[model samples]
Target: MKGLCTGLAAAAVFMATGCQASEPPTQVVYRFDDHRYLELKGWDCEGELWYTDTKQGVHSQIASQFYRIFTKKFVHPSERYIAIPWWGNITGGFSVSKDYGQTWETGGASMSPGENEPDGSNAPYYDDVLSFTVVNDQGFLQTKHRLYMSSKPFDDPRILPGGSGITYTASDGAVHHIKPTSSGPAWGLDYITKQGLKEDTAQFKTNYQGLPDKVPEVKGYTGWDHMRCDMGVGR
Candidate 1:
């Protein structure tokens, strides 16, 4: 419930907000006008990859170190893979681990110790940041701009083939559901919002197209080309 887009009308006016997709965003304005409740990042790991829970002050056995994170839900899809929307880049993109989180890949580059080649040159990036979740072996990428689905352990941040018709719709002061296509992932009831319908994927690309592609770098964090290791990329 923390990540659901709610109270947009109760907050500041939903003005003409904009952001940059290629670098860290400095102007992303949430429709709710309350940023404290947003679930901006999430992380998970497996035997092949490990991470540290800084709050607990214990590093995972799979890796010698871990990074700080604020997660809503961190789940394991398989023994060899983990996925998360690294800190700060919530809408920027996703960080994926094919080797049990020992390393992470994002924006088409490896965020680990020279683990894999960067492959996201053509991928659409987000910076209004959101969250990631898995259900029934399927990966879901949620951003302020859109919601996307992919096979578990996402290979890219782009929307999976046949991912469409997934949007937030509100009616009668409650939520509504439109059955998803076969290839589309089902929406979690928790994300339902009464403030607005069609918020999930409405004008997705159109909204992103208004933002800049290159995000400005965040100080003391990994650049767009690297894994947000500091945001808990590895175990």
Candidate 2:
């Protein structure tokens, strides 16, 4: 039977904020690498998010508003909450509403946010940009891979806890897994070409360890189940 990681530590990526309008509307033209796919963003008078993808072969639109878009987790020293990011104007960020989304407050820190708190490890970016804001902290717009955990994990790869990032091997019994970070939030099925087998967790090591000798780049999407393996995570 398929399983999921229990407890908050394993499923913590869930989270997000923010207003309908005051500054007209903002949008993003998500033009992919393909020849003719141009995406446009818009909001209805009632403040519902909409999009239209136009291409030579396929032209389509989202018929309704998304109640909640992208989400991330938020935790203070004491309490925890989910933050939902939405779109309004061409600009986008968190939307705050006390009576659900019946009414919205535009252009606050949650909307027009600030930069993430400076971490010395975070060197300079090409540009100083703010991604999203919640409470006092801001979560930047990241273009990283989404690592969804597997249900029947021999050991959940999402949580190694404290000390430092740890590398792992799946119970699937493969040649091995090759990835960027030893640990993050995933149970990716990387195809390593090396030959070996060890079930003991102690056998896995963390570092600049390389992936298998020859593996094609991973493309497409992934879901919470095996049926959607085409959607695998990361390279």
Candidate 3:
């Protein structure tokens, strides 16, 4: 009789520990500023992108099924324009928001007049894109072979005549130049594998000290469990 009671207690403890391990930890993926930032609520580096704007009283899932290693986001200094360059094995394109992420538009690359070759195409491939940045009101996408620039906020990107090494002003009022490279933005370098999450979490605590830790009421959040990352294979 005593042995039976001991076995039942051990089983209960095991079940409790399993339940606790299943819950994901919330993490701040990126910080646009002190009040506005992006967070992830999944295991390790796989999760969705949740935007939090404390000043505006807005918190919602702007993008779903976000993997930190593959996806990269660029926000204008003014926070008005936002772009996310997504690449996958079967499909690749850009998701752009011109009005502070109220709405989004996704499509293939559109080249300016005289930018495309006679036989070449304007379709952007996943492996062709190396890096992307938003400086001032313009967007620049650097591919494996050429550097494209769009002055009208990612409408029709054209090849830069000078081809990199040109200076431009950022949202911080600092003059900066673009250096063409063969690699994309280094994601997940500061956290996880590179720097331990403990260190990164401490830095976030210092950076966003006094900021609200409560999750705001998302207007249209159906449920985090229902959200799935189904953009492509290997996600």
lDDT of 2: 0.26
* Candidate 1 wrongly placed segments (more than 4 Å): 1-67, 71-77, 106-130, 135-137, 151-235
Off by over 4 Å in 3: 1-6, 70-78, 87-91, 102-119, 125-128, 136-138, 149-235
Find the candidate with the highest TM-score and give its number: 3
**Pairs in steric clash, model 3:** none
User: Which has the better lDDT: candidate 2, or candidate 3?
Assistant: 3
lDDT of 1 by residue, 1-235 (tens): 5444466543433432222222221111111112111122223421122443333343332222232342433333332444444444433334444454345443312211111112322122444335454434334444455444442223212344544533434545655433333222211201211111133332232222232222222233211222222333322
Which RMSD values do the candidates have, in order?
Answer: 24.0, 22.8, 18.6
Scored against the true structure, residue 137 in model 1 reaches a CA lDDT of 34
Q: Model 2 Cα RMSD, Å?
A: 22.8
Q: What lDDT score goes with residue 223 in model 2?
A: 13
lDDT of 3: 0.44
Any idea what lDDT model 1 has?
Answer: 0.31
Q: Rank the candidates by lDDT, best first.
A: 3, 1, 2
lDDT of 2 by residue, 1-235 (tens): 1345554434454321122222334333222223322122333322233322233233333223443232222211100111233332213333332221233334311221122223321212323322322221212232121111111112233234433434445767545543434433222111111222122232353311332222112243121111011111111
Q: Cα deviation of 138 in candidate 2 (Å)?
A: 29
- What C-alpha lDDT do the candidate models reach, one value each? 0.31, 0.26, 0.44
